[model samples]
Target chain A: MSVLTSSSEAEGEAIVLASLVEGTAPAADDLEALHRRLELAADRDRMLDLAYTTVDSPVGSLLLAATEKGLLRVAFAVEDHDRVLDVLAATVSGRILRAPRRLDRVAFELDEYFARGRRSFDVALDLSLSSGFRQVVQRHLPLIAYGHTETYKQVAEVVGNPRAVRAVGSACATNPLPIVVPCHRVLRTDGGLGGYIGGLEAKTALLALEGVGAR
Target chain B: MNTKKPFEKVVAEHGPTVLRVCRAVLGEHDADDAWSETFLAAMRAYPELPADANVQAWLVTIAHRKAIDVTRLRLRAAVPVGDVPERASTLGVPGALDHELQDALGGLPDKQRRAVALHYLGGLAYAEVAELLGGTADASRRAAADGMRALRLAYAIPERTGAGK
Candidate 1:
């Protein structure tokens, strides 16, 4: 029996194994069809509440996620897309699917903003990720206007708490919706660029993209 | 906390592998049903799965369950007493080779067949295969070896003869 199980026999087994996998594999189109069917099924069952897709921008790939409530999270590629999804899966329903149709309006707005065709985003905002004073600060960001700057102190005062300057900074730093919320426009009292969750480069790029000069 | 991705990414990464496992276990005709059921069941349970869980192994385990379900359903349907239908031919390149290999795989006993499919096609280790099949790891290994030996005799001989011509 050992004589029959030589190197040639091992090679033969490998060949057979290869043939077996290759032969019975389902077609690529079939898998795609299945995915579409599953997507519809999940949607009908109301299980896929969070839908997301990646959109190319001047900075890099941006992960745009949405729920029926509205556009929820926009993450930079530098933040690690996988980690972002994990957080969404944990905090939000893990019923997330990459159905780009739900993000069509958001993608279009982002594209328009990057192309300098739009000054303000009209997309619906979902602030479920933010709460308390942080939520108050986020709601005030859009009032700063495009191509303009607001000191954290100014934002703190706008939300009716000038003493909450540091809180304003923290809220902007953790802003779940960056570009859409216009958090990059928040600056230091000394006219400094301050911090942005998408990294300083993206902050500078978004500022410059809006013609803010980011100085 | 463990990180989890959207089910779309999961399907893109592992759909083909799962399909192969299903086909290896249930053959072509019923593999589609098994594959669909596996993913549907997986999607339902994906959210509750621990973040750090091994996704491929998890998927293969689901495929194993789905394959068993398919087999049971097929057994029930097969009791009609009419002549059994022929295995449908696959399309495209290597169709003939695939047909021969499918025939060779179809000739094995159930345990040996599953051992070879899970270990060789599904890329599971003998220990994992044993865990899925409820046998000792050693038993799974022996079954795979025996199955492969039989497959070589059944599948490789024709190729060798054709090449020699």
Candidate 2:
């Protein structure tokens, strides 16, 4: 497991990195690496299991969580285990599945959240990052507020690595958690909302929710 | 949970749900205040959270409720005024996109705009957008499609043969 895991992780990081630089959807090889990362993702939620639930919203259905760790993860149109697994094996991990019970709260509450000013998340979580820098990045994730975004340069400063713009970009790209980690909040220093793993449209929509005009 | 930190960990995981809600509910500047309020509510209500339920969704729902309350307050506090114009300027504003594409986007209905924003701006899945806006994926898609269609028709983007001038 260790040897396969190490190899998988190394390859996964590479794929994720490539996708980031190129601005494209991850490929099969990329999913493989992600899977390794998932298996190796921190056991912060060790005792807790992967659970989920479906939440209703304006756009579509959301897989939410009711786990002790709060909302674990949310995926969209996420059927077809083979493909999801392929993605998992390449980027996140095969260990993750439809965690309905663990994430049901996401479904139950997101509608209310979308409609109002209510803040603070009550769910616990498995951050699932693997490096010191990654951990540092996660630390700065929550500082970003709604309706606003921070630049990669700004994130580098917050993480105490003012010059590591590339690293900040990498962190945003490799972020195990997307919406939860709030990587969308990271943008370009030139007032441009930067790349988001979830998709540029989603990034824009999230920003637009703030009534932020445009880029 | 071994991978997560205590209070902060869970908050980090689900903060976006609240943020997304607040973004739609408040102004670009007021969002943080709303977000803080949501989190404070979460902190206050944290102890009573269900032991085995999905918590992230719960927090989002709570945030939504809070957002509605605030929007109501803002609407109520506003004073009636003289007749207002049907459209406001989205062009030439500092920090505005100032592009034709932006103008077309500005012309969309609020729901359509929100849908397009979630799809094109927020990076959420169509399903996620549906979840955020309380609609279906098809509806979200159509809204986005409609938004794009309007842009295409108004700006003649699809009809243009040239890549760029």
Candidate 3:
């Protein structure tokens, strides 16, 4: 069982070979540059099925993902960016890369929104992650004006299903694009802060930023 | 229970090792090209890869085919050259070329070099190496051992003793 003869010794050989190969593992920046090059190539070839990047926001790190269609999903730090990426890889397409260029517009919009300089997101939306009633609920969420708060009941009524208030709440809870889709604008009928996928502080911050004030 | 991680995670974890294998097989100048091609192809097909598949081995397999393609392309290009010189340092990934080790690796027979590189640098098992290079696991094991012994002798890698066995 010396390090040479066994198949398990392959790892041992890697340990020894790591030093002898091209001095050291090409510095991290080198690999990153190579990765970026690959991202560009993939993009040029139209093979980049999903591209994502993170943006620092008032909420926390926001992971923004997009497809060729448009902005696909927006997730908060609480959602675990890695796990969210994994879910994206599994369900949507594993042809995903952290190519920030695709999300530049999304990040810019978020920055403007958080700075209280923008009223609504003007970016294209890819509502493919939601369908049926959920998709309809998400599509209607953006119409609830920036400074205005819509109760779950009101949103349900507007969506032509007044009996589906709790359904609307679930739709808001599961809204794939939180800030950009404006799920934070929907509230409990009593005006108590409702559930937010980005967490309550984020919801509160977003509403405050929009001049809704804390209820 | 979707356990598949992002392709970015796959690249982050396995990128270096695959780069080493590419460099070991095709030297520095062409290695990055092979690596870029390998990952791009892998990324394209990654959605269909089984969740539990061995990603490193899968990547090495792809790298091997890309390396072969690069070698064939280089042969066809036929820019006459002598020994591959020590690379000048560059802004991007400094090609800290160890010419002696590169020469020793280049001196090896093709199968032996491929065996050593795929098994050691690429971290593929003997069976996987056999699948790539087309021989028995035992044969890949032997070729890798022979290649390593030759490399150690030529490059004068000091034999360590009594660390653990």
Most TM-score-accurate candidate: 3
DockQ of each: 0.38, 0.01, 0.39
User: Candidate 1 on A22-138: residue-level lDDT in tens?
Assistant: 776667777777777766677666777788889998989999998888999999998898889878877787778887877999899899999999999898889999999999999
Q: What residue pairs are clashing in model 1?
A: none
For each candidate, what TM-score against the reference?
0.79, 0.39, 0.87
Residue-by-residue lDDT tens digits, candidate 3, A113-147: 88888888898888999999999999998898889
Per-residue lDDT of model 3, residues B6-117, tens digit only: 7888889999989888877777777888899999999888877888788999999999999888877766576556864332111123265466666777777888888988
Off by over 4 Å in 1: A4-8, A24-37, A90-95, A213-215, B1-13, B27-30, B50-54, B68-97, B106-112, B123-146, B158-165
Q: A153-205, model 2: which lDDT tens digit per residue?
A: 98898889998898889888776555656787788888887776556777776
Q: Which is the better candidate, 1 or 2, if ranked by TM-score? A: 1
Cα lDDT, model 2, residue B31: 37
Measured against the true chain A, the candidates' chain A TM-scores are: 0.90, 0.62, 0.91
Off by over 4 Å in 3: A1-18, A21-24, B1-3, B80-94, B158-165
Give the better candidate number (2 or 3) by TM-score.
3
Q: Which portions of model 2 miss their true places by more than 4 Å?
A: A1-48, A53-71, A76-82, A85-99, B1-165
lDDT string, candidate 1, B1-165, tens digits: 644777777888998898888777777767777878887788888878898888888899899998888776766666555664442222122332266767777777778888998988788999999998887999999999999888878864443322321
What class would a CAPRI assessor give candidate 3's docking?
A: acceptable
